[model samples]
Target: MATFYGGVPLVTEPIKTPRYDFVRAPIDQVNTQIKNDLLYSVSNLPVVGQTAAEQRVNKDVARQLLAKVYLRTNEPALAEAQCDAIINSGKYSLVNARYGVKAGSPGDYFSDMFFKGNQRRSQGNKEAIWVLENENPSIIVNGSSGSPQQRRVWGGGYHNINGMIPADSLGGRGLSRIRLNNWVLYKLYPQGDMRNSKYSIHRQHYFNNTASKYNSIKGLPVPYGQDKQYTLSDGTTVNIAKSDTLAKINPYTLKWGQFDPNDVFGFGMWKDFILMRLGETYLLKAEAQVKQGNTSGAAASINVLRTRAQAPQVSASQMTLDFVLDERARELLAEENRREELVRTKTLLQRVAAHNTDGPSQRQIVGLTANNLLLPIPLNEIQLNSQAVLEQNPGY
Candidate 1:
């Protein structure tokens, strides 16, 4: 609540009746309350191994959240302390080797953690601190609360292509509601980063429909470049360069891809969501370290993830706040909310203008200013509290 809006009403106890006239507390007060609550949770919550329920929250979860709160409140030392506690607890570790259900399959270790059978702690994901379990509705009643659109939003609409059909290899049918920008797709990662491997980010598409003459014995590569054309087996040319940029042939993240044979339309994704993990903890620690002018320590923290990913290691000279943000994008693209991270660091406006201004004119970010840092409080919320004068954010 304090992240998006500077201040919010602090309601500690449940209200049996509707109440108005409540005023927004100061931002510091809100942070203090959050810290107190999380400190209590850290002291009282059970350790990781004691709980049989994989979905339950533990002390490490509280510590991670508290670390994030500390970072937001400019308490870098406190944030680093929380991260140290979690790291030293020995409850979690980064997944370095291939040890999931698809261990023998053709996939990298970084991508294996995201597979359905490999998400839970019981299923070899040592990095997973919190996972929201989801079950197939056909098998269990009330299995999923609602249909999740993550797969459709993150995966590409490859089925819409001329000679392609929804296949298990290609992530199921997607509506392509979101398409990756040029900066992320082309220029983010170096040559040998495992996160940019084919298994992690499905950049290439193939002709899979057997009925189409364009289909090859060894799945013909679909053309992707601008104004590109391919000759079919029937000696006819198909212009695939003009395919829909948003859906038909765009690169997408494969983390949320799951193909359901029964539901080809893919209205819902019956997959577990990894809410918190140890991979992100290191990033948080690095951020806190960088804030305290310990760039060497920050570099060491980031190198742990880099060593696992086999990406190039950095020295203390290259450890800047901007570099940390870029590393966050590389590590947690679809998983983390990019806007929230930027807003918390106060780099949203500049970063957007630098990297997100490419791609199509319609899709580009525009008219962003300092006032956009905090969203304007809803008019209805202020009006509903008729008894008190609820102030709007500056320049609303």
Candidate 2:
């Protein structure tokens, strides 16, 4: 409701190196080179061919970065203008047409968020303006095995080990932590909501004898309440001995189908998480406009997205910063980019604590600072360089 500054929100801290500053003499110069390298990852965009695609990315990046800097620097109009450019560019739209439609059931919501098939190119993956080229889509989950191909496509990997199991290192090191916010669970409406149905659940009957059309059925688990473990064709044990977090599973992932009703983790947690989309951009632009005294403009922007989400339209009277903030939290949950969004909006700690009061406070927390704007910075640079002691991010 009230606006405040000097806060950073973080679900996880970035890795910090001891030495912290190697690779190049001028940081700006090094960053320019790094930017060039990032552009080369996409195949459709010419790494060496025409520069138009690069130009497109650059424009989008510049517009976003400008708002980020300006918002933090007190140049509201500049930030507003840049956001407008992104919104009106028409290159992207916040509305995800396919996912937003009413399937007349909660199942559709679950399918949209976690279903591997829903994320493919045909499903209006057009929302993803920038696609990270995954040579192989392999990912690791709380002490689970993964393969590159299946994780990326239809066969995602999941862990249905009892409940929320901790990752090996965290658990081995005795740092057990696997709990979901009850509020989040309640809001998820796991009952009839289709999205909730896709999560990890214990369906013993179908699980014990899953008939997969793909490789082998050995990896899937047997029905729950049984003590023994099953091994997959890959030789990984189906039931882990110790787990940190337990999943009701039914309301937690994109996995859905009529099974024996045993607990399982699905394909596993390997697929790439799409962090940015035109939808969030639309929301951000609208919020910026609201902050800059453009109530009408802000209303239009927010409604464009709400319309797509299938939620009711919001008028100018309801265009408070608090409303926008909560709307974003609900709309963009689990996107992995919300942390940065809260930070850029300059209200991370306050908003997070206000909503998730159980976490650590701002200063007491680690891995956030004014300078550490862009994450994904290489650790090697920190290890090789010495200035890192003063410049390395707060929580490494």
Candidate 3:
């Protein structure tokens, strides 16, 4: 119920008869259980502590989960009211300025939320709702990592770039494994938006290796200027107007650019990962308000995040589910699960069919249908039960 929907059976015991296991639970029943459990925790748990905030049930997070459950349960008014509670709590506010250790630096507010030693309530970041603290492995024993993999999972691996080597200045090392869709880069935000600016996204590559012939210009940065040309070590000119044609990748997101100086290859980033923040809460509230036909309220909720980014404000007349999803991508890219969000809003097929350039080109999303929405039940689950025949999802 908490993770998935559909007519999945809830097996409560270790080994139950096939007759009992074959009985699938209704979607509403599972949603009710999830809602009850969250509300119980919200009503019984104390507020998150400032110092030892571990394993604590945050009321705002509980409310947010309940609101999501209500949205799936067809209770728009209930969802809206749950979000309203968090909005008026006054305990949490969006971090809208440079703060913490790097307040004097040139970094933006959005990027600061992910920095190490700055993702907790005690760290002066009031926006963090829930955070994962990754500590030093020497003291915490595997709390960080066993090898060179602390940040590579989310660091947007960039080592594949032709001449762009890993360094502290270039957002540590990256393999560029996670490439954004064309729509996420080009259509999600307006020009001049801080979230997509050069500061937030590392779009330039500089020659930093001193061993090459271009070593004289080692620190010379190459921008994606109109005249896309670079002189190689052999004094040969290379035209890389098309970003993909060049070894150095362009317009990569820098939100997860955490660098560990101790890492031999600069591939291990051991910063704490942010699970939930107030910025997303506002978006969730806006989504609930939009579903309830409160267009003005929805715009106001969304405008708070946009204003912080110094982007254009949204109008009440322009509020829609699609617009809300787009704003989510702009603000929460690589932070939340994209496929779940799209599936929850019933826009997976439509959005993918329209904006998924690579999917169609690779023949992956071809002939996708509603049947593809729910995953087929595992064949092992059906075969293991001997008392009764367990049914499988259609188009398995």
Candidate 4:
């Protein structure tokens, strides 16, 4: 709440009676409240191995949240201490080798952790800090909260193509409601980066619909290019123009792909959502280090992930706030809430102006200003608090 809207009403206790006199607290007060609550949680919560349930929050989870709060509040040294506690705990580590349900399958270790059967710690994902388990609602009543659209939002809407079909290898059925920007697809990754591999990011689509005239090209790469044409086996010509490839054939991350043979329509995905993991702990530590002018320490912290990813090791000279954010994009794409990260780092305007201005006018991000740093408090919230004047954010 404090991160996005500065300081919101601190309702720490349950509302036993009607109250409308609540006013926004100072940002410092909010941070102190957050720290107290997290410290309480850290004291009460069990350690990682002590919890039998994988979904339950552990002490490390509280520490991670506290670390993030410290970072947002510009207490890098304190954040670094929290991060050190989690890292030195020896409870979590990065997924360096293939060890999951799909370990024998044709996929990388990074992508394997996102698979439905390979998410939890018992399922061989040692790096899973917090995983929300979801099951098929048809068999288990009230299994999921609601239909999860992660797959549809991140995966390509290739099934909309005439000669394509929903398949497990094709990331099931997706609507491509959100397409990755051109910078992510083209300029973000260097060659041989495992995170950008075909397994992690689905860059190619193949024809699988047997009923279509392009059946001859089944199990073959879809003929896609900017304004290119191809003649099918039945002499039917197909033209995939540049304008038609925004969502249909665009590249997307495979982290949210979950397919069920029983539920082909995929109204909901029955896969565990990894909320927090050790991979991000390293990034948080690096951010804190960079803030304290410990560039060498930050480089060492980031190289832990780089070595796991098999990407080139970075040096202390290359360590910057922008570089750390880029590494976040590369390491935690599709998993991290990017807007929150940018807002927390106060780089929304600069980063968006630099990398998110491509594509059509409607698709581009525009009119963002300093005022957008903190969102306007909702009108309903202000109207409901009639007993007090709830000030709004600046320039709202």
lDDT of 2 at 346: 67
Superposed model 4: Cα runs more than 4 Å off: 228-239
Q: Per-model C-alpha lDDT, please?
A: 0.88, 0.44, 0.71, 0.88
Task: Flag regions of model 3 displaced more than 4 Å.
Answer: 1-5, 11-22, 50-52, 139-142, 145-157, 212-214, 221-250, 266-269, 357-360
Instruction: Report how far off residue 260 is in candidate 3 (Å).
Output: 1.5
Per-residue lDDT tens digits for candidate 1, residues 1-396, read 688888988899999998878899999999999999999999999998776676899999999999999999899999999999988888889999998788998999999999988999999999998889999889788787378899989888888877778876677888789888899999999889999999999887877777757655228777675666667788876567654566777889989988889988878898999989998999999999999999999999999999999999999999989999999988998999888899999899999999987767888988889998899999999999999988898989
Estimate, for each residue in 1-396, the C-alpha lDDT of model 4 and write its tens digit: 787899888887899999888899998998999999999999999998688676888998999999999999899999999899999988888898897677888988888889888898888888988888887878788776478889988888888776787888878888889998889999998777899999989888877778667766677777566676667888987666676578898888889998888888887877889999999999999999999999999999999999888899999999999999999999999999999999999999999999977777887988899999898999998999999999999998
Cα miss at 57, model 2 (Å)? 3.7
Q: Mind giving the per-residue lDDT tens digits that candidate 3 earns over 112-185?
A: 77667788777888887777776767556667643444345444444553445676545677666566666766
Deviating ranges (above 4 Å) for candidate 2? 1-58, 94-96, 99-123, 137-179, 187-250, 253-273, 357-396
| Runs in model 1 lying further than 4 Å from the true structure | 212-218, 228-239
- Cα-based lDDT at residue 367, candidate 4: 89
Ranking by TM-score: 4, 1, 3, 2
The alpha-carbon lDDT assigned to residue 391 of candidate 4 equals: 92
TM-scores, one per candidate: 0.95, 0.53, 0.86, 0.95
lDDT per residue for candidate 2 within 130-246, as digits (tens), equals 433221222323432243322212211223332223222111111112233544545533243322333332122223233342135433433433345655565655454322123
Global CA lDDT computed for model 1? 0.88
What are the clash counts of all predictions, listed in order? Answer: 0, 48, 8, 0
Best by TM-score: 4
